[model samples]
Target chain A: MHLSEPYLSRRALLSSVTGGTLLLTLGACISGGQEPSPTGPDPIEPVLAASVYLADRYTAAMAAVPDLADRLTPLRDAHQAHITALTRELGTVDDGILPSGRPPAVAPAGSESTPAATASSGNAAAPEVTASPVPLPAERPAILADLQGLERSGRQQAAALCLAGSRYRAALLGSIAAARASHAEVLT
Target chain B: MTTGDEQLAEALRAEHAAIFGYGAIGAKLDKATAQFALQAEEEHRERRDALLLRLSQRGGTPPAADPVYTLPVAVTDQASALQLAVTIEERVAARWRSVLPQAAGEDRTMALDALIGSAVLATQARRHAGISPATVPFPGAPA
Candidate 1:
């Protein structure tokens, strides 16, 4: 995949030529006040869950296949950083769906599996999401490709959110989208 | 607050420099890699040209590209050429990332698109350079 063409950039470029004006027109219609038009179930929470989901998936893949541990850890840590940065914007994560997905300021790298309640939202317990929303494949190469797929999908989702989110959050969303896009390249 | 046009002009400036940097970079690379380098340079040129039109349409004066830009590294060989490529893409990405927070509509779309393009190219350049990890946690973020 070293010489592979960028999967999303091509589509993004084409859409940007046409979508930019249309997106603003649509935004103008619904944007009665300062809040951006809703694109997902929630503003930033879904992005939060998605990052937690990715971080947990990374932890699972690392534990399930030890050979990839060295390569996967940093990618996992990136998701953790995404969580902290996003939660900072959302204030406190009392959304109920994710609980204390927000770490107590900074959770150590290894704390992804703390599996204990933290004071913020008791949602740190969700870290032990050993059983993910998407099940893992037991095979070796399959799991790597599987994780790569997750990164790619997550990248697309984040990119969409980044486009629709507020200008205040655009930078963070764009960074997360870019990070996930890069993570897929590293998976192999 | 930085205006979107200001950021766009800055990114256009970065794109101008990237096109200039790629010329030196391509000279040091092999035929196959140089072809890749040419494509990268072409993309920057396209972006620079587009941003030029965009800024004019918005009634802003686009900055002129310098006749020559100071190379970040002396590209004596392929390794240094690749290093310069990475450096250019990172600078380009940082410029577009700055646009994201300030621009909206088509401008923001262009910013996001260009930012991702720069990030992807940077990863490819890093991989070609044999840099480990080959990807960044945040593409435009300062090291």
Candidate 2:
């Protein structure tokens, strides 16, 4: 059988060859396998860093209230994904998961749960280093309030950044802003 | 019309559709849910009017709202109404997302505001519908 003689066979063969090469090229491009550029710090770093900080808050909240883990985990996971996506957009590393040294603060008496303030590590370049201040909300209500506030501020910051970004970058930032706004609603 | 004005017009169109959808949704919902729908509808109307005026000032003809919109799902009960509300917000968010690329300065800020509002409303509606997680990782991005 002369397989190449059939029009279907020829098209299929060509498509397979080109498709495989295209997939590999796209994968390489997405994975950022090339040498790093020597440009100044990425403009998106601050937003990514803020996401990392929010993720840390979730971690602290979960630690304080183990019972709320099921609810808080998903929120934390979303922020982690945000950090990953934003950092990847800048072709940077995804080391946004650093742990805080402080212990989780227990909810104060009379309150549903006690949450410590968000602690800034004071690194202007990498704001994600700001730890969660060991703020842990031991109850569902407290957790919701804490997360709602954090998400609100995060949404505002991300939206501000989106205004000045390029199209693709702005789209991503806008999505991040939208996600945070939803987070606030969900927490509420 | 400039690109930004055109994008704003697109967003305005979505708001018009949302206003129509919310009217149907509010009718089928309880007092609280219906109130949410009404507020959302009013918000869309406000934005729509503002955009229309802005387009007019720029000498761009604002696209007319569709006489009718087909809902994605039948909103027969509260659950369905909630779902429809969520869908409307998500659709509006997608439109605002498109506007961001062409917008600048205050226009960009407005688009971001609209996107954020829709996203929050979508989540709120999903929460009312008893959807798990209650939040998506990315809102207004195409799957």
Candidate 3:
């Protein structure tokens, strides 16, 4: 039985045949298989790097307080998952993982000179402290709240990263974003 | 109303909401967690600023944030609060996807990545909650 070219009209068939030949010629013209373009650092790399640093902090916390290990293990794993997914997509990873080299001495909420200082330094300045810097809260509720907040922040950063890297690596960024969102929920 | 500018405006709105949500989430967190939340908030602020700059560069006015944003639910417990956070990120991802059609190359890639990342995060959260369908079928692709 002969199959009819219903899908491919005469003009379409001619174009396809021509296209195929052109593709073959083009392939032969190039010596090596199309070399992957030298990709620059993806915009989302910094955020993923930050997440890895945060994951390390969580791991440290878990180690320090064995009781919190169960609570933080999955979160830590998720961050690791994100780093893997992002790095794989970017084809490179940044050496630095921390979100800025040094931790803030104080919060940015109640600082007078902090804005000016940050502007001059071109980095976030440590804000003044009105509230006392007590030790980490002991209560479960307080601790959970903190964890939830941290996860939310991580999710936001991931989301931004996804936005920044969506076009070149949709699948990778999507996976990372989803993981961050999941972390937020788990922390809550 | 649904011009490129409008799409950008919607994205900016999502950024504002995210920044505000981080504040609520930060309140209950510990030192390390609080620091992360604060940094995330700052990042969103920076992105919002960049959006405004882009808009102005194109001779368009950037959208303003509302006086207050309404939360999907009260963040009374960690579980509920995290659920809300997940939802917010997903919503933002959806909005970014909308803007993707108009964007190209790097910008488009950025939007796609953001959407996917948000979806992955949401899935992780769901699994933590012991829920089925932890990850969505396609996090940032067209529905």
Where does candidate 2 clash, by residue pair? Answer: A107-A114, A116-A135
Clashing pairs in 1: A100-A123
- Deviation of model 3 at B106, angstroms: 4.3
Root-mean-square deviation (CA) per prediction? 9.6, 15.8, 21.5
DockQ of each candidate relative to the true complex: 0.59, 0.62, 0.14
- Tens-digit lDDT string for candidate 2 (B1-143): 78888789889889988988987887788887777777788888888888888889888789998999888989789999899998899899999998888887778888888888888888878877888878888888997
iRMS per model in Å? 1.1, 1.2, 5.5
DockQ winner between 1 and 2, please give it: 2
Q: Model 3: which docking level applies? A: incorrect
Model 1 misses residue B93 by how many Å? 0.8
Provide the lowest-lDDT 10-residue window in model 2 chain A.
A1-10
**For residues A1-188, could you state the per-residue lDDT of candidate 3 as single tens digits?**
01111111211221222222322232232222222344423354444444544454455466556797766666665565555555455443243222221222222311332212232233222121112122344666666665555555544544444444334453454455455555556555
* True lDDT of residue A130, candidate 3: 13
Please name the candidate that would achieve the greatest lDDT relative to the true structure: 1
Candidate 3 TM-score over all chains jointly: 0.42
The 10-residue segment with the lowest total lDDT in model 1 chain B: B1-10
